[model samples]
Target: MELAKMTPLAGLVALLALAGPGAAETFTLRIGSGHAVGPVTYVNTSRDFLVPEIEKRVAERTEHKVRLIEAYGGSLAKLDETLEAVEKGILDMGHVCFCFEPSKAMVQNLNYFIPFSPPSAVQQLAITRKVYDQNPALSEHFSTNYNQTLLALSGYDNYNVGTKFEWEKFADLSGHKLGGAGPNLVWLEGSGTTVVQTGIPDYYTNIQTGVIEGNMLFPSSYFGLKLYEVAPNYKIIDMGAMMVNGLLINNDTLAKLPPEVTDIIREVAREYEQVTAEALDRDQAAGIEKLKAAGAVITVLSPEERQAWAERLAGLPGAKAKEFTEAGFDGPAIFRSYLDAAKEAGYSFPVAYAIE
Candidate 1:
């Protein structure tokens, strides 16, 4: 039988039941993630915080028969390989950061390059979930290509202008040396700003040595990476929210699980998704405060400045959609569906670009 032809939900239940409840029998699953356990005084909170939570839930719900062995902090796999790793069962499940593979994961990063009206974490999460739920084709694309299931979708905090140079408009970026991830390179175009491809880990020193003038990143991540001390200016671009991470599981692994065990996993994922969202919301506000206390200047783009930047990239939306469709997916339609659903859910982008 074709794997795609078989629906996922029921298959999962039978597999778990077959594993049986014999006291002597133990089933082990290895899940991979990309953050390490750190000291109590760490700059960024690790996935270490989530490990115990998952273990507790699994033990309580599965009679302690299933063990989720974890590979943390890219020890088992790195971000770019995670999607394929999970699908090929190189690891049962893993953390997939789309930003690392934006070219291949266009649909996943559609919003990463766009600007948000409020640029609030809570609003971004709400809109993301609604957009994900409303677009099955977008959801299924993952299943079809990676042979994995997207357990949950979440967004990171908004990107702030972290730089040695202060910026309030797109033009201010001109002649500036900047480092950025994902599609942020587009922002440097026509502005004379030179784009440096520095990974997040190198952002701090790169700025300090004059290797780059500034970089764009989420405040939480900037704090996590300690870029504030070197650059010391946190400018709110309001361009868009950043999506740093998500989790995916091998479909074959998921299909092999007993329905009850699968149910437990799904429930735990949903719970953690909410926990993550709330934490991100709080962390975003907290990060800004922490950076401000540390002497970082925060710049909020005025309405006129925001519009000017938006105008410079006037047809960016169409170009993005077309790029996706040209890649053999319904990129334009997928993009439209997300926006329409967001509007339906009461999210109105101040400047609505008519997507083809």
Candidate 2:
């Protein structure tokens, strides 16, 4: 006989087996991130700000039934391996650097690396969110290739030079050993300087040992990593914002979560998304103050010089965008939309560099 036509006992046993795990146990999800337990750092912001916020939101929405175990400061896994770790279930949730996984999400990081584009953190984050929300293929690609889901993005500031020497313009930067990460290399290309590529965590030592004359970084990173003591010239270039980082979760873990819990997590991400932008502004101001107190030279690039530098780097972005588009994502269009959004947001690009 068919199972439906069999016994009542068989039906009850089947139902019990199907519902057993969900009804019998409480789930403790382990959320992992690379930053330390407290404030934001070069490693990540979501670990410091977004994780707690998400936990609070989830608890409030789900009646405190769900528990999340936070693994911070690479206690669970290395910073560069976050995406892979999440995919392998070594981490249930993580703050992944899309730059580190460029093969998986080059379009997103290309916005950061493309020179002379994305003028502000708010605009950058806005466009990134819009693009991800609109592109099903991109989202599916992340899910299928990495087994992870992008929960939120942490925007970056316009990188500037913090150096031992005064640099009033890009021309003044010639022949300096500027330590920086990926995109800054492109920015410094024609400046006649040697670009020393080093991790943010290693910047302090690199400077202290005279391995680099200066480094390009956002103010928060300069302050967070104590770069002020070594190279104290803070010069704002306003070239563009870096993509900085992203928060992601294991696709399987996210899929298995109660829908309400997942919704709460995303809700908190939407709220914390602005934290990086606002914090960047504040940190930039604070970094200027700290540099002044430390007797460092601060030079704001003049309007004419900033204009020249902008024009010089402008072509690089389009070229890089083509490279990304060829790899299959519409990088040029994404970059254009980002710039257009920045214009719509009332940012007068080439704001005359002046001391406030």
Candidate 3:
């Protein structure tokens, strides 16, 4: 009899009978994320790319099977609590945005402090993955300090200035309240732009109420949030693609998994990085066109002014490096390695950061 003709129950019985003396062990992994599913978003990528690939690879390569329980869209934990949730074993795995917990995950926020490295999301992902692979200190900080294993690093397109008013020159931002989150607020310093610590959700209302004149955000977010309705001017400053978020597994949960399963998880996670990078690139292109159709004014800063903005924020990276060192991390070394990896990948910065 052909196995293909068997009923579902019959097929399961036959498979178990084929195993002879033992039944294949099954494990359940509960994965959580704060964000909801949306096209080209990280949450969507996790469902479409990471989870299915992991399940397929594990079943193919091992005697074990995994059942994934997804708890996304803040069902399990808020965005800020994701890292801690994974650390405390509330969830077996989760997506954590380092920008959300900058102090706790200071070392992981390195890319946010340094701007103007590269404009391409793929290049930025390569640079960050290289640093994480080569720099033991960075990976260790996640595993040892946070009790989580870094599965993959992913990022979005370079940020631009979304404004209610026209931004033809850098000087136009002087005395204007620019909305930014976490370390990016440092980018506006010394440029005479007063920083308003705000997040994506509040940007629209804030701009309409004149609470903030503009925000430093990427095209994907700008279009997704429909910020063009309020902030009609979009300045493509190419402030460098940022490695803002990561997927992590609880160290305790990882330790309990079979070695083959762990290996597959890590392998699939790397592919997740590539998948997300490509998605960001695609979304950015589409977003720009959408913004144009919506009648948003889009412009790119002149190369000279872009370089000048970089020069003005030159001191931020080195100062952040010092803070890293004082916090018991090799901040300067990681900073140098990040730049080196970027340079080796053919990325040239507008201003050379003073790491020494």
Candidate 4:
């Protein structure tokens, strides 16, 4: 009886040895965003595109699997705190909006400071990707200073003004307090308009309470936030599409991932950028239609007036370049490269910014 029991135990041990390396390891990734899930929003892209693609690709191409733990709508980190949270490893990944931390992300905010480039969402996305891929300094800044790796970049459609009053000419904005985020606020520097320095979340309350006469934002945000109910006038300024935010992974978490899994994440991130740009294009058109249906008056400034606005802000880009150069970045080279890319992409600016 003892010999028979010993033989079965030896057979069981042999069988266990043949089972290859146990099951594949499952790595859990926590992706956090301040934005909530809504139709035609970046959060939708994260939920419907980035997460699923990463999961599918990892399963198909690697022995490891990824389990995405999503924490959106400020459940993990608010918009402004996302970069810090990821750096501190509180979240594995996050969407960091450069607009929120302009001073720290000066290089990434290049698009915001240089207006009258490409207003097409696709072109803007392509230009930013191209610039970032070619410039090692920009990438180094993220990894060295922030303890994060940038996977992809995304942006909104061209900015427009939504106001309680109509805007026909530059002079029409005189004495009006308009709310805008940093850097873009400088676009109104000499237009006789007062900058409220507010963000999108506060636009509705500010406009409704007469604290601000209007807010500068894209059509998708204006429509999604239902700002037309209070600020019912829309002016299409076409102030160039901006690279607003990026998908970033904590460096420590990225270092822990398998090589194959890391490759898939990078591949899917490029696709995510394309999908986001396409979504912005679609949503802006839909948003415009919705705003019109909701009794929002829509108007486009004439070419002459648009050029005048561009000239008014022409000093901004060079000033920004000087500021960056003083801070040890090759700002003029980056600025020139961007303009060259925009030109190659078929964009003709109304006013040429003197970067040199």
Candidate 5:
């Protein structure tokens, strides 16, 4: 009988026959993400690279052959529900964005609290990983509170400035209108720019129809949205290349795996972080070129001016550190530590914010 046409009982019997007496067990897993496959790098890389790479490594390195049942675009779980969904066993594993779980994973999102990071995804992820290694509670919370293991970390592309008009310095944005969803709003605080509460979907029409003149968003998103047609100027803010997305697996599912398989999965997951970062770096670079080709003017904010903008937001990071410190995590040290790590790695911030 064809494998696809076989009944459940027959398939089990056939599998046993093939294993013949000393075969290891294979596991089937359901993995999904709320965001669709294309727009979100985490979803795209998870679907194309992480899943298949795990299968290949498991097959090559272990006795078990694992299969992942894929679902993207919220087919299995919505955005904010992914972490909880995996916890409840509704999904064996899934990709999660901490932005959706503000209360649940607040400290995990320190990357956002302290902005003006380099646009390089590689550096963003490395700094976050170092912080995680220093602060065990950050990763521990996943298993301690959510009943899941964080297998890998993922980051978005560079968050640059896209505007309908050209501007040279931070002061140039004064009296202009811009749009952002949340958290990122503070980055524009000191500048007298009016911020419209809008999302990526509305950025195009909002700019075209005069609702807002610019948006603080990722380059790939800006290009993908065709905002260059309207917001034809790009500012290299390199605001926050955050490693805010993670791949998670339920502890129960992980506990069922043989040690060998578990090791392979974890190793592959770490590698997934690096490969996805490389992909984001490429997308960000390529997207800029595409934007220029499509008639967008690009400008790099001078380090001096960038530092001035960072100074405006210097007081904020400490406030966020307290929130985490009060939650019993080492927020202060980590915040300062991240800045130090960034500096040691030779990526200068516009301004070095202190964690009081």
Candidate 6:
């Protein structure tokens, strides 16, 4: 096999062989999201970190190359339907928001039920990942039910309340109206406030039109969306960061690829969790300052009132766990594990929210 005598295809094969164990292939993958990049940190990370890092890592370490086609703002699918889109290969992969897929992705909704988690995005992600790793069912729910593989899980920054007016205690807020995403609306339970179901993208218009007077949201999303213009009262309820979004790939598409490429994709996806969380944390910290500069009034719910609120909401975790059990999951165990992880990480919740 003299160098000058080698045929072109054979030479290329030799080069690939020298580079790695598997033959090289160029893969075209389509990644998408329901929301635009600026308002959603997960969507931003999909484009900013996941896409580029996978391409870079594969090229540097393996013979495979990846070509990612990105779509956002409901181009491929809405946030709730991205799971179905990925499952059916309408989009090769997409970011799935669990808040919208409540029934289908039950286990992934654990964070919302177990509220008042530590407000740190980095710590929240760590807790979620730990629970996911320890409980295989969390990840398996995707592959078993959706025909999609979970690549990585992501979290929103510290969730808070933004309103047109301020109230000191949950009782004083009774009879007002507030809006939030599907699962989180229950977080305001028993408050005289009427909880309305609203998504982040619609919060601005909904408030402006008087459809709702306030909403629950993370600071970064609140700032990115400019909802501060309408709802200038920032209430730091610190409902905790929630692992609500997931990066997923169609199983059929993954099966067509060689291990070299799939391995790189999975590795990069794991790193995506840390990168997205850290960036969201920074954005949240900065968002608060920006909101204030723009004339948003900020308030912190007193520790006593926060504890009272948590106590009022204490039944939620246990109730949801029982509901999960009826749906054929170990609800008690799952809830307990998440609580243990948070406690182990040294988060002293406002109250001892039990599984009942």
Clashing pairs in 5: 307-350
Best by lDDT: 6
lDDT tens per residue, model 4, 1-356: 35545588898888878765644789999998876676326778899999999999899988789999999878989878898999999899998878878777877888988877677788898888778877778768889888999898886777889899876898989999999877788788777888888776678899999999998888988998889999999998898778778899999999988788899999999899999888888888888899999889999989999988888888888898898898788988888888788888888888888997
- Candidate 2 on 287-308: residue-level lDDT in tens? 6676677666677778788778
Residue 97, candidate 6: C-alpha displacement in angstroms: 0.6
Model 1: per-residue Cα lDDT over 7-76, one tens digit each: 6877887777777653333457777754443311111222544455556666776655566687766677
> What ranges in model 5 sit over 4 Å off?
1-23, 169-177, 193-213, 302-304
lDDT of each: 0.69, 0.68, 0.84, 0.85, 0.84, 0.87
The digit string of per-residue lDDT tens for model 3 on 147-215 reads: 998888876677888998887778889989899877778887777888888776577899999999989
- lDDT (0-100) at residue 208 of candidate 4? 94
Residue pairs whose backbone atoms clash in candidate 4: none
Candidate 4 TM-score, C-alpha based? 0.92
257-325: candidate 5 lDDT, tens digit per residue? 888888988988998999999888888888889888998898899988877888878788888999888
Candidate 3 C-alpha error for residue 292, in Å: 1.0
- Which candidate, 1 or 2, has the higher TM-score? 1
Residue pairs that clash (backbone atoms under 3 angstroms), model 2: none
Where does the lowest 10-residue lDDT sum fall in candidate 3? 34-43
State which candidate, 2 or 5, has the greater TM-score.
5
For each candidate, how many residue pairs have backbone atoms clashing (under 3 Å)?
7, 0, 0, 0, 1, 2
lDDT score for residue 350 of model 4: 87
Where is model 4 more than 4 Å wrong at Cα? Answer: 1-23
